[model samples]
Target: MESEQAERFTATLEDKLQSLLTKASTLQPEEMLIRHNGLLYPALLCPEDNLRQFAKFDARPEDMCIASYPKCGFNWVNQLFRDIAAAVRKDDGQRKIILLEFSGADTHQVINSYPSPRVYGTHCHYENLPASVIEKKTKVLVVFRNPKDNAVSYYHFCQKHPLLPNSASWDEFFKEYMAGEVAWGSYFDSALIWEKHIDDEHVMIITYEELKENLIGGVQKIAEFYGFSLSVEQIENIARKGTFQAMSDNSQETHSIFGNFFFRKGVVGDWRNLFTEEQSREMDAKFEECLAGTKLGAKLKYDLYCKT
Candidate 1:
């Protein structure tokens, strides 16, 4: 079982990481900071320097990158792209999906050596992406969720993930999220930055709610984006096989560095259950202030709690 394997690796990983930490040059006893491009990121499971140098990943034009803010259905969209890659490039050898921040291989090496139509997933913002990705016109799929749901999901994710910092309460975490204190920075900032590129030929933006609302249609849109065509039956089969229920049931498919909790409650509008009325209004006001004049925010009409 994938979970059992992760359980077995837990102590080993901790031990190995502890040894590495002692030898690490930049990490401190109480705080480990990875500095890149003038930003300090905690050296959790993924190091900050590695991510900083990711600008040199040397992405190819044919490559596909699934970009998202954390906890905004990233894994879900990553899985969908993986399935699409498998179906579209069936004749080619199976391609490995690279999680840019966590992968061990040098991204440049991985991108250069991998089979055609390589897919890489990242939580990196638009400005931080490798220049080649934009220069070469690499196809990019950006999936965003309602920030209200994003914050709720991220709060729970931090609680579950072993290497992430913990939050004392939802209120505390919500404040951090709004202030852009969490990883990948503010959801509104990331959304606006990526939305600016939506008009580019290489970028396709889809909200998590849209995908959840129509999986088949989402698959079709993505397939078309990648210049691939699937039959009615094939699309139907992928949709049937790739449901949240199916992914949650299959341990290997959803295997995460932390655990399987990453797949928790893959539903839209669940933020309604988590957010207080006051908290919702606070988020709405912040969203309005931050997202003003941005197409993505305007599309949502500055709403943080509404279902689309």
Candidate 2:
């Protein structure tokens, strides 16, 4: 009896999913929409489908790419770059920042619209990026956060986005994350791939914890990496403008273009609030088992709380 009931439940779920897909397929490209921070965005679509004609998309040597796993410090860094570029070009009468999102339906259009010396943001794994971008040797700034905190933030983000019914529970979400079933693939794998190219002088890796600990220093490092130098006053100004309080207050409708606030409690150890001792240990063991021989194993300290 239980087996029959389970089978029926599974079939019902599959039917509902197919119905949703059919409805989505019926919509025109312009009619399909994505929501960000309570606002309807018409540009959200599948990256693979949108990027199919990838050759038309190109990058210049002056282009900048800010890459990070979701729920990391992408937006915070974006805001920081905006401030730095704005400050640098204050008297030059130039718009120093360009917003490029990888998953948007009009992403290619937006990227192609910008001139040289543009800044693009993406969550694409290294192998999946456009060939032109790699060939141009665009400056890449990659940031990473502790996976525990990333998972917690991602859980809440999924709750708002409603991508999967299974993500309603933390355990289900963690299972998908651990098994590398989520979009953008495994966090460890993505980081390691980028790490291999970091020595290229065009790529730099920044950690979220370090950014929080020293905002001014972080901004200065970013400026230096991009072949620009900011005075002490300018560094201070950028740091002040990029604060969580400032970002939270200034964000038009939301703290970020993404659904979640960019300044969502920009503090380390936030994972402690979400994971119990046993859960943390279990996650750490999983990380160790999966990434045993990888460079990411050394790059990330899964036991962040214990280390401190």
Candidate 3:
């Protein structure tokens, strides 16, 4: 289902990006990071110019998007969706531009030229999605994880990613995380926005815990939502191949750029080890403030995963 698609971005950095690429390559995250729309981001990627160009993209009727904040099950679910697409379409399920997170407008032009059913992923908030996605009513599969664990994985990821700044400690990172100071903006701010769309026909929302609990069922639901019909046997095979261990073993095949840093533990309870009691309380309070009684809040099952 997956084929190497890295060559598209291999050209030498464009002239306009020279400064950002230089800083992203040579400087620490502290010195290299930039802010866009109140969110801190790696200097080299998620450029405003590219994002502006992306806004003008003409989304196709068949275009479907997979979205999540960083460190949610983005890689896993994106791969799973492709596997399903391959089995259904019986073709190489290739996608251009991993996520529309680049510094050049050429990427958007290349995407416009790609074949139909162009599946793309994004970490941007729902409103920031391409305007055409809304006008065209393109379907989006949005995945969210318990933020406690999300923060832990993302904190470590920043250290490993050369372009982003590093946090001196988990405490420092957690502070920024709660403040919505990291890239992609505040998790809560976006979560609340997504909650309003819980009943939307075009949006299919799932949680990492739900996928972990029932990969086969989750896969089926995803396939059905996208109108991709897969036989029961095919769904099972896809689910088995997508288990955490299978994803970890074959990650190099799918996401070799990050090396081992693309995935760490990926366990639900790992945050228990990193968060202090005060931090846990703070997370609970934050959840209460933003997502307490909403339908999406119930979907996150915060007490079961984040509290207990």
Candidate 4:
């Protein structure tokens, strides 16, 4: 009797999986870029899955790169940078922040269409990026969050995204994510790769927790790093507008303003709501084992429950 029950459960699981895949296959191709190992890959549903390659990085003195593991405060940092740039320039109109993606539709072409002093967002792992970006001394601002939080956020992101394969449960998603089978591979590995170059003059590592703890100070440091001096009034203005409450309230503003809702939730400790105690421990073990000797282990102190 027990054997029969087990077999039935397995069959039911398989049927559910098939149903989910059918739903995913029917989703129309959204305009957002697909990412792989940090490099943006072409849309999965595109006619040909031809991954877009990055052009030679023609980094000018004013070029800036905002790099992050997905859902690790990437959009928030980009918005903050845009606000600061605008404050420094004293312009209030809708400013075009040229986001350069390695894959998907030609964002480079759009960036080229615009003028100088561009702010570009990318998730391309350090080794995969264009050589010019490194050699030409372009400014790089890397933001990383706790891996546990990142995993939870990524799971939620995939659930809402028609482009990704949706998991029936958090357990199923965690299995693929730990094995690096999911898009962009392991978040812990991605952070370690960038952490190696963190001390370079052109690269600065910013933790999402640190940024959340001190928003105004964080923005000031970023401005100073980029050699942009701002007045007290300007700093206050940028900080006020960049708050999570403020950004979330503004529907017009998001990571995918024209497409999907990229800025879903800006809060931390969201993993607790979704992760079981056993699953949380499993994730912590994975983090400890995988990131044992890496620089990121030192930089990002993971609190699975965000207690500390």
Candidate 5:
């Protein structure tokens, strides 16, 4: 059975990669979309079909989803989810979780096969999500980081990971990021789409900076959102277990899915070390142009949170 499963996964991976390469071949230098099944999707690692299938997914009321732009402290927040699930749903047997865009198998098949209280993680923008996810009141947690930090992290990620296309330099990648040319598309648009639904009873928005500032409090907030009451000590334990150090210590096992070193420095404001003064101003100007006057932009607290 296991061998059959492995064979199926490998075959699916080859089929998807061939399709993507064929689609990518017809693109011009400036064109980034990988055409699949009559749909254009960002040139990301996963097969676009995964996201399309996820859109058609029928979500249950007990489903929990973690949504974020790539490299926005997703793994860290996911650890918290793991800890929370272990604490609150201990008797529910093993938890089945899916990273929607990271797998080779049929994503919809995997998800639908999972038992009740299914947990899913996705980088798909809010606009791409299934209507049932919202209409069914499935719990959704959306997290984000300052675009500058997010770009810096992603630049390094693209450089180090063999899966992604190589970036020539920070400056080159910065331009791409600023122009919203990177994989998974624009971080601004991703956040903005989800932010509009922040007030929905099924959704909660979190920031990496807020979790850094008060992990215990952040865990408490998530606990509350899940309607799971944790003791003070339980919260502290979850906070400690979910720290960057803890995650880093288990990096090899935790990040084996990505097949590379997935955890970098978990500090805020690391962008300061990379961004030149002029570049910083340029980024600020771009942020203002794209995000200013928006409620999502207003709450970003970029300067205050990142610099501190």
Candidate 6:
């Protein structure tokens, strides 16, 4: 009995998992939307409890974090981070990339046990992150995508994620998205919080558009921020393997469960296909309201990707 509790995800993963299965069978979609601290979460993941548990995580100065709003190129950026890390440390290439808030506390425990220069992540709003992340001065990489594309990707993801309420269509999802009724809450609210930290000495903010525009340069830039000094050859090699096509080809091997669900078109401006003139204008107005005049806003280059 004691041994069973000794497992890492005792409360959230092990305990809540059964509840998730049970609830998934019995509960309506709306019933499954758990609210905590003014944010919405899927009951299956029990993110509120997991987040409360993650609050105790003992952050280390050497830890590097990938902090972002969901569907904002996290997987692709994570792939690049892993490629660059493996090229540098030559470890099993598995030490990096774990779900921060979504994974159970037990997983965070395992992370605590790992050695230095650890790579961890969160898709929470900036203010909701563990306070220790700021107190410890842990290096963070913030990734954002244009809101239209981000919303479109997340809407599709909701269909496949068992923990999430699947939207019947993009139109319905867009209304919920604009209202910040989906999991992880509003992107605009998150951008507002993170915009304040863009220039912090320990934080590096980059956008999907920027990385797409300059993959090699972006990889090199992120590597250097994490205190890695890679040769140009190594940067080129990492970029080669980290390309969208290359990663998509290997997604089944790496993300065996979800397979290629995480890899749609991997393109910017895809929202163009789905969004109407009104929707585009709404997203544009929101961006200007939440992020305009900030350094992150400039970094996102709104005129280039999200301009009306």
Q: Which order, best to worst by TM-score? A: 3, 6, 1, 5, 4, 2
What's model 1's lDDT at 148? 83
Model 1 agreement with the true structure over 1-308: per-residue lDDT tens digits: 43344344444545655665455444442353354565435565457556755766778778879988898788887778877887877742234456676544444454565567788888877887878788888888888888888898999987775456667888888888888877667787788788778788888888888888899999999999989889988788778767998877763534634337777888878888879988887877877677767777765533544632
- List, residue by residue over 1-308, the lDDT tens digit for candidate 5: 43455356555655765666577566554455464433334554555665656566788887768988889988888888877877776642233346765554465665576555566787777776778887788898888888888989989887775446646789998887876767777787787777788788888888888899999999999889988888999899889988888888876555544434688889888888899888888878777777778766766786675443
Clashing residue pairs, candidate 4?
none
3 or 6, which is superior by TM-score? 3
Model 2, C-alpha of 40: deviation from truth (Å): 22
Quantify all predictions' global Cα lDDT against the true fold: 0.73, 0.64, 0.79, 0.68, 0.73, 0.80
Winning model by TM-score: 3
Q: Cα RMSD (Å) between model 2 and the true structure?
A: 12.4
Error of 6 at 141 (Å): 0.2
Which candidate would rank higher by TM-score, 3 or 4? 3
- The better-scoring model by lDDT among 2 and 5 is 5
Number of clashing pairs per prediction, in order: 0, 1, 1, 0, 0, 2
- Runs in model 5 lying further than 4 Å from the true structure: 1-44, 91-96, 104-107, 257-260, 306-308
Candidate 4 local accuracy as lDDT? 0.68
lDDT of 3 by residue, 1-308 (tens): 13433343433333434555466777755665577666666666765676666667678767768889989888889888877877876775544335766535766666666666677888877888878888888899999999999999899988887667788898999998998888887888889888888899999899999998899999999999988888999999889888888878876666645547787886888898889999999899989988999999999999899976
TM-score of model number 1: 0.84
Q: 52-156 in candidate 4: lDDT tens per residue?
A: 345454556677678887778887888888877766655552454544543334445445544445677776568766677877888889988987788888888
Q: What does the lDDT read for residue 178 in candidate 5?
A: 73
Best candidate per lDDT, number?
Answer: 6
TM-score of structure candidate 6 = 0.89
Q: Report the C-alpha displacement of residue 147, candidate 1, in angstroms.
A: 0.6
- Each candidate's TM vs. the true structure? 0.84, 0.74, 0.90, 0.79, 0.82, 0.89
